[model samples]
Target chain A: MLSKKQARAFFLGGTLVTFLIFIGLTIFSLSKDVDQTNHENITEAVVRGKDLWDHNNCMGCHTLLGEGGYYAPELTKVIDRRGRPYIKAVLMSKVPWQPNGRKMVAYGFTNEQAEDLIAFFDWIDDIDLNGFDRVVSPLAKDKTN
Target chain B: MTLYKGKRRTTTALVLSMGLFFAALLYLPGMLPFDSQVTDSFFRWWVVHLWVEGVWELIMGGILSFLLIKLTGVDREVIEKWLYVIVGLTFLSGVLGTGHHYYYIGVNKIWLIVGGIFSALEPLAFLAMALFAVNMYRKGEKKHPNKLALYWTLGAAIVSFVGAGLLGFAHTLPQTNLYTHGTLVTAMHGHLAFWGAYAMIVLAIISYAMPNMTGRKLYDTGRGRMAFWFSNVGMVGMTVAFGVAGVAQVYMERIMKIEFMKVQEMMEIHFYILIICATLFTTGILMYIADFIKHGQPTDEALIKE
Candidate 1:
């Protein structure tokens, strides 16, 4: 097995293995995660929708891709769940969206902008994240108590 | 340094600062906001990154030195040598490691390479500390009878390596950082690194110093053992909850391009798990603090050696 002189080797080797697992996960996941590769199909409306999303700071109220304020519901799968029209209606109408007593900032969206934002959501919605958010997390099972 | 007085006085190596570290916590108090999100975020990150890579390391060194001397019963010469090496490694990798903060701050292109390399090395300093502790532990002929203090001392060293060193390097590399940046992945590392390196050490120091300060030999108590295990297990569970939430967040929001708010809703249950875990962690800490208080005010008689 290992000798006293080989202790440094044990340290180096163990650390090296852990290092390998980390970097390996990084490379594998990052490459697979670039799911929206068909930017070739990105339209002007979708581009404008993205711009609106940014300038309006919808992220200030709602989360996008799990990055944002916790005051609003997630919009990542909104298009899939409610369809493009629903998203457009929500943005276009002057509606109150408060979850757990926190208020969302009101934004006035025009028909054209709403159309563009809808397209953008549709574009991103097509990107594959496998089974993410499709159901309740198994890790949350029986532990919510 | 002379201009400062009272609590502001630069005690120890002139680097032990809870100022910037605590100031950074005040920067972002969870669910709070700045009027200008962009500028606000930049400064918030400045607090966090500067803290972990900065004064917190000095705190680690100071506490480790005190504990090693008290527990290891080793020659001061050997311990001080390790202290010098740790301090050197800390500043060397750490200052440059601040560049990692710049990558997210919308700074210059040079920070990409600079932060990447240095931040990667940040773990090396922590690793050295780990090796130092375990090695000294092995070499020492007499282990202190205070079993709880030893648990904490050794735990701080080893866990810091795993949490700060390994988990940190996981995302420190720019190639990975570019993708994992700002996602729950960062949260995962942040929780573990902060808990392992900073929180655990402080607890370890308190565990060591409490008995000395109070002259109470409570180290052998069941409550002491319970406090240690409950806190550690609760934190590890919390780390896992945060990890999955971050991963799901990244996958749903970043990868699948889900509407961000919807993803947050999906991950709501995980936060519930986080709350449960946090409760356990807080209870454990409260138990520790309560026990420390029960010993009453530190007295001259308590300092009397057996």
Candidate 2:
């Protein structure tokens, strides 16, 4: 049997070798699958959509991807849930608060700005997000603690 | 024994404080839906800032300094004052800098400016403590075969302070914070700063304390390096992805004026990067756990066979 020091060395060394192999595999796997649909313009449009989210401070009312304020819908996959015109109509709806006590107060937008918002939403809908949905229910953090 | 007694008392208090803070974190999320922007921000500072800067940091510095004193046979008096200074400065600057988190809460711009500048001073204290630890290590050469654990402890100190404190300053200024807050850039900082400060320090303490707790010859050089690489590399991956996604959000929101829902959809792709990094990070933690569980060879004379 090996000494304590020698056995310690063996386990540590074994772990290192395995970790290095894992690292190599991770890099190799990531490089092989470049999705062709991830084009430049579409990518840029997606980027613009994110900027819009932050500037508006949507987290004030809405939850997205399990992060953010919980007063509004989870919006990680809003495109799948709602249609293009529906999204545009909602943004431009001029009706500002359907009254019965919803926490979200709407911002009045011109029809053209609303259309731009729709275009942004449609672009997001087109991107592949690997199947996360935007639904508003209590999150894991809510249910567990 | 008196010195050890004092150290033990301090450590126990620190542990209690940490446990309380974690309990608070577990409870705070439930407070949402009733969560006001300001109230939530208030608790965020209390949980994240106070723990790292105010309490756990002071505790860690004290415990490590005490260990150094014992290990190096240095007079504990000489180290105690320096430890106090480090801990004191960390708490003072950290608490006042709680104002930095106030920017989004509709606090005055002046508080943000002052908090940003004062928070910048935290890293200098870390740098001095790091230098002192290195100098102490250099003084005590070839003392024990297990001296390597001290080096790991020092590395944890350096990187934790750098990732949590130094890089923290990079995006903390008002201009950068404007673009980054509530974005993936903010998420990146949360990941690195918290993991580096909290996780690495815990690992270092485990490496130091486990041998005594288990009564085994517990130091393993190879596994330590593997854990270190996996964590640090995965952190780098997460940080880069977060940065890219943050910049992307900035372009989309400020420049392109895309709607909020659409921006979120675009940001989903960034989750793939985080998922991969999480896998590597989890693997690293598992390997460390394995090393701890199966500690010593059964037949070794140096180990007390259970």
Candidate 3:
């Protein structure tokens, strides 16, 4: 029979070891067969699209997967939802505001900016969130996670 | 035991509420993806704001308050005052910031401006608290010896303010927000603010408090430092990569008028940086866990309180 102190040690050590193993296994499993592809650099056109996006601060208005200052629609699946042509057309509409009665206001994007914005949106679409939770940014202009 | 038990219960309750709220916000949106009306999106924002800047921040404050009280032995009054101000402002600005999100949700342009300005105050408030915390840590370090927790506390403040407050505010200006709305730069903010400001603090508290609670000093100073470096560097790398990629994506999609799909294919180049960062972050988390586990072999003296 074990002493009380030894028994306590045994329990704590056992629990800690088990937890470490679990974590290790999870990490290993996720890393195995990982895509191992890199996506940090892109062409000048994409970079230009990003510059235009930043110059305008589109995220302040729209959200991606529920993040960003809330003031825009959730654009995580925007590509999936609106497709490319509709998205581009909407952008080029040059209608900055929705007048008075429309449910959604139109932010005017330059023809070039509209294209870049769509490219940016498309870039995010390929990410595999793997069913992660979508949480919006309160500061995101008009967004839902 | 009574004092400890009461505080633990409170902490547990706060943690439970946060978990519940996270679940609600994360899960409920998927149920109505097809019903992508503006109103539906608004409902999502309500949860996002309430949790991120609202109750979670308050919970974080309480945790910080507890850490400050323990580490500095400061009077509860001062700490509580900090809590009141931080939490109070968070709630105030947070709720009002909902107006900014309302602009797209079938609301008027006037509200966009209102929400824009009000939400801008959120980062400033965070910045103020961060400065106060860092100042306190600095003062304490100069005056005291047993101020180990202060380092992490200072780190939490600096990163929270710089990464979350400053970077976040950079693009929040109404004019600037017009284009960067859903880009990777936004992703950069989310990663840093949530992990740096919120997660790091919470993790630091756990690192500091667990030893006291468990009557074990298994975590080593060296390992703690290693974890900090790893996590911090990883976070920065991830943010920068995502931010740049976000810019690239925006340029491709918005300016080039390229099909969004084509733009995404182009943006894949940044995946390497993101992957590396994620690996580093995971390594950091692992190191932290190792520190917790190996914080083994309690010191001989006072392993148990009399």
Most accurate candidate by TM-score: 1
Q: Write the per-residue lDDT of candidate 3 for residues B1-306, one digit (tens) a residue.
A: 443466355432443355455546655643443122233344566567656766666566666666666666665555555555565566556555655544333323454565677678778658766866765554443343323355566677778777767777776665555555555667778888888668888786876776766675434477677787898898889988888887886576545545444555676768787999989988888888887776633555636452
**Whole-model lDDT, model 2:** 0.57
* Alpha carbon lDDT at B196, candidate 2: 61
lDDT for A128 (candidate 2): 33
**Which residue pairs in model 2 clash with each other?**
A12-B223, A47-B252, A48-B252, A49-B263, A50-B263, A51-B253, A52-B253
TM-score of 2: 0.60
**Residues B42-149, model 2: lDDT tens digits:** 455556665666566755676567557655655555555456555545654665565566554433344466567767776765666676677666775435445435
Question: Model 3 misses residue B51 by how many Å?
Answer: 0.8
lDDT: which candidate is best? 1
The local distance difference test score of each candidate is 0.65, 0.57, 0.59
RMSD of candidate 3 to true structure, Å: 17.9
In terms of lDDT, the poorest run of 10 residues in model 2 chain B is B33-42
The window of 10 residues in a row where model 1 chain B has the poorest summed lDDT is B30-39
| B173: Cα error in model 2, Å | 1.2
Ranking by DockQ: 1, 3, 2
Per-residue CA lDDT of candidate 1, range A1-145, in tens?
4342243344335445534543353333234243222445578787677778778888776644434644555565466566777676667777664544455554658999888888776665554332222321211112333
Residue ranges of candidate 1 with Cα displaced over 4 Å: A1-96, A99-145, B1-46, B298-306
